[model samples]
Target: MNKMHDFEASLQVLRGSETDITSEVNVIKTAVASANKRTAIRFQELNQKKFRMPLILGIGLLVLQQLSGINAILFYAGSIFKTAGLTNSNLAACGVGAIALLATGVTTWLLDRAGRRILLIVTSSSL
Candidate 1:
């Protein structure tokens, strides 16, 4: 028997089972090899025509999101709110955070039901 079969048999013995596990080990090895082959095929197919547009779209959306200035607004929310004449700047900032949290929760709830593209269009347009 091979080293792997010997190792499995030893493991079975340690686990208090005297039954041969060579066949089980061979089956597991076969399954692993098949999975590896499938993974290799998928990796090779990542850059194919069918995946190209969606890949580009996802990257473009990320780039646009970064360019949207939302990050800057969020980072300086307290100062911005103060500049806008809000007496309680920190409270205003907290309100902004709460609204953002609520929007995120609503978006997550709507994602599957509304679908990604429609939600993306609506949100991006609103922004």
Candidate 2:
């Protein structure tokens, strides 16, 4: 109740004198109702046949992402580099770490612009 009052106070401050607490409360109620409707619709959609492919693809992608050996490689990178005849194994490991960070940043930037299908194809192919 105290948090709700604080939220109302902040909202009142933002709206200035244009609206009252009742209006703010009504607005919140409307938003909640809208979200509930959307949730119900999504739940219904999940039961339909059309959504099956997408649901399977999402699950498969998640499983593949986990099963990939990237974590193990990163964990044993130093020894791997040493075994591969690198004189400075630490420097090689650091290079791998830098590449991983840069790849993550690049992937984030590309995801929104290139879209998921294209990005996934590119990343999977590169592997």
Q: Which candidate has the highest lDDT of all?
A: 1
Candidate lDDT values, in order: 0.84, 0.83
Where model 1 places Cα greater than 4 Å from the true spot, the runs are 1-6, 15-17, 30-46
Lowest lDDT sum, 10 consecutive residues, model 2, at 35-44
Q: Candidate 1 has which clashing residue pairs, if any?
A: none
TM-score of 2: 0.54
- Please provide TM-scores, in order, for all candidate models, with all chains considered together: 0.71, 0.54
lDDT of 2 at 76: 93
Candidate 2 lDDT score relative to the true structure: 0.83
Candidate 2 Cα misplacement greater than 4 A, ranges: 1-21, 24-51, 125-127
